[model samples]
Target: MSVFPSPPSSPPSDRRRYAIVGLGSRRELYQDGIEKVHHRWSALVAVCDSNPGRIELARRRSTQNGAPVPLGYLAADFARMLRECRPEVVIVTTSDASHHGYLVQAMEAGCDVITEKPMTTGAAPCRQILDTCRRTGRRCRVAFNYRYSPPRSQVKDLLMSGEIGDVLSVDFHWLLNTHHGADYFRRWHSHKRNSGGLLVHKSTHHFDLVNWWLGAVPVSVAATGKREFYTPAMARRMGLSGPHERCLTCPEKNRCGFHLDLAASPDLKSLYLDHEAHDGYWRDRCVFRADIDIEDTLNALVTYNTGATLSYSLNAFNAWEGYTVAFNGTKGRIEHSVVESNYVNGREAVQGGVAPGGVKIRVVPLRSAGFDVEPWSAEGDHGGGDRLMLEDIFLPEPAPDKYLRAADERAGACSVLVGIAANRSLESGARVQVADLVGDLPVPAYAPAGARGESVPMPERAR
Candidate 1:
């Protein structure tokens, strides 16, 4: 492992300095973008994380054989990265609960920030981050790469083209197969306190799609959720009399279908299995642990300011991983279904993208015969969204986007509030108002329901 750089030291030659916090599985998306894809224009100045082992692992993975290793810091010295390494932008890929702190402090320390989605865990932290952005005048960009996915971008284009007329309602159901879905239960994400459950952690991407597809802000959300699968009882029912704390030591390792061999994948092996001593963060905890607090199934009804609504559901343990979304509009209905290959995150190069030949889009015009609409196809990682987002963030000569895929703090807050409200509704068994959670937020400039690009405000709720 590379030694931590001394304070007040200069970073690699003349290039934009970026410091990344959190060396978990998701860190590769941004780290590789800076080091491999856009290394010339951007320099990875420093990496900080609570886990020394993960930090060392990231250092090895991100640095080329002959390249000067980027600096490393313990999480406590994050401020040192700002003052000493002097990063122009801070990239936060930390645990869900810690994002707001890093985001707010980085901005206050005179740096722009880029963060993974959901922005913050809940409404309190969301409001703080928003207020910090307003006070510091620093940009906080949330990575919502789904908007840039080719087939999804095409869906947005079709909706904006107005052939579907004004959107009135949306039906979206996302499924996560056992392979990918069970992994969530193994990590910090299994608890609501750490990840805000899947509603905030996983569904942020889905809810953002709905908000952007309709070009509206969510006003009210009523939801119901439960953990029907991934239970200790289910494991016993399957005849696994003995289940270990994790897959690595389980007595039923060979017999259990959900067992994850951390040693099999070089990436997962180096990144997680070899580093368990640093933080005791097991990479393969049993999916049916009784301590798991988040729901495995969720259903929500969301109303938007544009009078558009969403009927959304998420099933964590399913036969396959993907989503089917249908938009109902004044003119017609647009439906899209995608099947995605599911793998344990960080265990493989392709995390979650469109499975080969897994995309289908259909259009049904009102008072007209419905026909299949062939849309633009995608190739590459993350359905070609990650590459585009990387270029938009790092490259100086990227194409201007009409879909407005780049998301700001406002958009990030708007998306997570839906899930946050859903979590609340799940507990109270009543509809929860989004505005009641975070006060009113400015509506994002989303592409209009028609081809016209106009900014529309979600209707003001009577407080």
Candidate 2:
């Protein structure tokens, strides 16, 4: 790794000081925004992680990107970073369960917080973070970058305009192919205590999008989840005998389809492999580990406060990625489907179906004919929502967003509560209510249907 100049004395008056807590691959998404696109508006004041190699690597990458090298802080010195770096905003990109600690600390220290999705793992942490945000009166922005994706944004606009009339219900199903989904089993996410399972960790994105799209909060949820696939028996059925803790030393490395050669790629090596001394975290654990607690298959039935019901399902070991969602409304039904590329999370290129032809959004009117809606597409990962979301986050003077795209603690809490409820339902085998998890949670602000009042109403033309 390349060593570079020291940290700058102080941020300019035009910029906001930022300290990122996690130095994993997800850190790059935010670092790129600060270095290349938002230089004028944001500065990387400090970077913190448990691993020393990642800290140095972040500094090297920042040097390469023409950004000022930030001060490095170990995970133990997170409070010291707040005291010395005095960052105006603390970005929590840590593991799922650890987010609440950083969020609470930052808010209590009179700093705003921006966190990766799922917010925190369980209901207790979620309550604590919510209380901290309210008590400290600081903002906590959850990065649900999917909300800004062009095709999804179009769906939001269509719903806001009541194009499909009042959304009565939804049927949403998301699939994660073997490559991408299996990667979770290889990392810290395999344990329910670490990630609160995929329903909370991954589905937070999907649940949040649904809540925002419908302009409502989830009220009740009944769910079921199990580990049907990715079991030891399945691995043995593939003619792979014996048990291995991780793939790095597995005898079936050549034969196993799920082997991840972390040492082969320099980036992966430097990011994870070379830094095992400090954390002892293995990034290439066996996908079929017997101790893995997270469910590979999950189904949920949710009712929103706005009288909208959703039947949702998630399957990890699927043939392809992406999703199919349909909104049933009074006037008509709008359906959206996508096909996405599958790969290990931080490996090759960006994730999701950003390509032009892979996504389709259609409208079927109740009375007239149906028509295909050409989606508003953008380039980059997660259907190009990351860049747009970054613009909103990093820009000093962002344009007035009527979509209410910038999410606060309420949005953060409401998003995770659905999954939290679902997780409870999975355990109890009964319907779980969101309010029962977090009592009297405030509603997220959404624009009224009159947002498109200036536009003329369209009637179907004679075919």
Number of the top-ranking candidate, with TM-score as the measure: 2
List model 2 lDDT by residue over 1-463, tens digit each. 2222365555576689999999998999999999888888799989998887889999898888888788888888888889988899999888998999999998999999999998998788888988888798898999999999888889999888878887889999999999898998998999988898999999999999898998887889999999978899889888889447888899889999989999997768889998998789889999998999999999999997778899999999999888999999877899999888766767778677554478999999877878999988888888789999999998888889877888877888888988989999988999998888889787777623333223334656666
Instruction: Tell me the TM-score of each prediction against the true structure.
Output: 0.94, 0.94
For model 1, how does the per-residue alpha-carbon lDDT over 164-189 read when each residue is reduced to its tens digit?
Answer: 77888999999999988988898899
Instruction: Report the Cα lDDT for residue 24, model 1.
Output: 89
Q: What is the lDDT of residue 297 in candidate 2?
A: 97
Point out the worst 10-residue segment of candidate 1 by lDDT: 447-456
Clash pairs, candidate 2, are none
